[model samples]
Every structure is written in C-alpha cells, then in structure tokens.
Target: MSTSVALAAALAGFALGFSMIVAIGAQNTFVLRQGIRREHVLAVVAICALSDVVLISLSIAGTGFVLGALPWLMTVVRVAGALFLGGYGVLAARRALRREADALSVSGAEPDAASRRRSLLAAIGTCLAVTWLNPHVYLDIAIVGSLANSHGDARWLFGAGIAAASVLWFTTLGFGARMLAPVFARPLAWRILDALIAVLMLTLAVLVLLPLFTGSGS
Candidate 1:
C-alpha cells in the first residue's frame, strides 16, 4: 500500500505537470522555433527544463510561503509581465507580417563557428527571458507546489516526477521539432505561427491584467 501511494503521487505529479505545460504560449513558441532552427537547441532545452525543475523544487520547498508573505509581489509581477507580454506580442505580430523575408534570411544565412556560438548565447538569453518573465510560470509553480504538498510525505517524490516531466517535454519539443522542419520550411507556415503567437501573447497579457480590471489584485 505504501508503494502504491508513492507511485500514485508520482503519476499524479506527472499528469498535472504535463497538463499545465502542454500549452501554446510565448515560451513554448520560442523553444519550438529554436528547436526547428537547430540553433542552440540543447542549451535552450536545458535552460527551460532546468529552470522548471528549480522553480518546481523551490515551490515545493516553501517558496509559496515567501509568495504568501509578500502577496503584493504577484500584483507587481502581473503588471510587469503583462507589459512585457504585450510588447512581445507586438513584436510577434511584426514578425508575422515580415515572416516571408525573415524566413528567407534565416534559410540563406550560413552557419559558421562564430555565428553558431553567437546564436547559442542569444538563444539561451532569449530562453531565459521567456521562461522567467512570464507570469504564468509563477502561477503554475504555486499550483504545482500546492498539489505536491497534498501528498504529505510523498511530496518529494511528486516533485521529482514533475521535474522529470519538464525534462521529457523539453527534450521532446526541442529535438522532435526537427521532424517538423519540412513543413516549417514554407514561409507561409512561419507567418501563421508568428500570427498565432502574437494573438496568444496578447491574450495572455489581457488575462494577466484581469486582477486590475476586476479590482481584485491577487
């Protein structure tokens, strides 16, 4: 019965973690693109997956207490995150409009050692920004933390399960993206993707501002 409980907690953790993360959003889009481009794909995946692990672990270890102690912090984060997401949305929209040319440039560019190194660094920086700046991350971590603790002494195992989910998802998304390279080769696909990204980002920005709009800042 004890073994069963631990397995159950781990499975629950995996399911919840995957469900929360398997969404289309700014961070995912950026990661997907990096994967498709094969530009620092490993680094981007590592950063994203490891960041999730750290955040998840911290939350399980009582970051929620810190968040609870400073409830106003989330409000500030929400406002800043909304602004940042909105800005990125606008940038995505612009990219959608010019995707044809951008795709052409991407395809035409030659990858040299120096260029590859620069691309790797740039991709890592972008991945960090995408992962850290999004308010959704904090919310998810808090929720996951709460869920993990629900398992009592099994929460650590649960946390490990969720961390594994992060690793699996990112590894698959980053590497599996190559399989879709043929379809994305068309500039039209890139345009559509960017347009969708723009819409998603803008929608997230609006949702994040709901607290301010409803006069219930949480």
Candidate 2:
C-alpha cells in the first residue's frame, strides 16, 4: 500500500510538472532558440534543468517563505524579467527584419576557437539569467513544493518525479530541435520563426507585469 501510494504521488508530480512547463514561456523560448541555433545546446539544457531542480528543492525546503516574508523580492524579479523579455523580443524582431540571408545548416558555420569560447560563455550567462530571472519559475516551484509536501512521506519521491520530468523535457527540446534544421534551411522560415518568438516574448513580458498594475495576485 505504501509503495503504491509513493508511485501514485510520483506520477502525479510528473504530470503536474510537465503540464506546467510544456506551456510556451520565456525560459522555454530561450531554450528553443538556442536549440535551433545549435549553440551550446547541452550547456543551455543543463542549466535550465538544474535550475529547476534547485528551485524545486529550495521550495520544498520552505525557502519560499522568504519570498512571502519579502514581497518586494517578487516585484523586483517581475520587473527585471519583464525588462529582459522585452529586450530579447526587440532583438528577435530586429533579426526577423534583417535583410542579410541567414538560415540554419546542419553543417553550421565554425568560428575561430576564441570566438567559439566567447560565444559559449555568452550562451551560458544568458541561459543562467533566463532560468533564474523568471518570476513564473518561482510560482511554479511554490505550487510544486506545496503539492509535494501534501504527500507526506512520498514528498521526496514526488520531487524526484518532477526532477525527472524537467530533465526529460529539456533534453528532448534541446536535442530534438535538430530535426527541424531542414525546414529552417530556408531564410524565410528563419524569419517566420524569429517573428513568432518576438511576439511570444513581448506578450509574456506584458503578462508578467499585468498582476502588478492590476493589483491582483498571480
């Protein structure tokens, strides 16, 4: 009976985590961009998945109480996230409008060693910022942690399931994106993708700040 309960809790956690994360959001958008570009895909995916693990663990450990005690923290994160998303959206829009012929290639361009190193570092920094600065991540962590705790002894199992989901989803998104390289080989396809990503990011930025302006809890 105990083992069955644990399994059930684990499944529930995975379902909830996957559902929440599968939605189109700023973090996921960034990951998809990196994947499509084939730019440090492994590092980007690792940062995203590991960041989820740390946030969920902290939430389960009751660190979320800190945010509750300090309401201003959420506000800071909200504003910063909105700014970041808005900036990225503008950049994407510019890319979409550029006249230069740019398209994906399976054999992608190879930069010099120093250039590759610098680009890798930049990608890592952006990945960390994107993962950490999102207000939605904290909200999701809070929900997941609270639900996990409801399972009593099965809480750890539940968290493990969530961790598994994070790893699986990010892995699939990062690596599976390569399959689309053929379609993105067309410059028009690249433009369309960048345009869509720009709209998504800008919309998410407004959504992140909506609660603040309306004085409603998200």
Best by TM-score: 2
lDDT of 1 by residue, 37-58 (tens): 6778888899999999899989
User: Can you give the lDDT of residue 56 in candidate 2?
Assistant: 80
TM-score of predicted structure 2 = 0.95
Give one digit per residue, the lDDT tens place, for model 2 in 1-218: 38899899889879877988887877787788788879899999999899988888898888677777787888999999999889889998999999996887656577899999999998988888778888888777667778888989888888888888999999999888888888888999989989998999899899999999999844
Q: In candidate 2, list every pair of residues with a backbone clash.
A: none
Q: For model 2, what is the alpha-carbon lDDT of residue 101?
A: 69
Model 1 lDDT-worst window of ten = 99-108
Q: Which runs in model 2 stand beyond 4 Å of their true positions?
A: 106-109
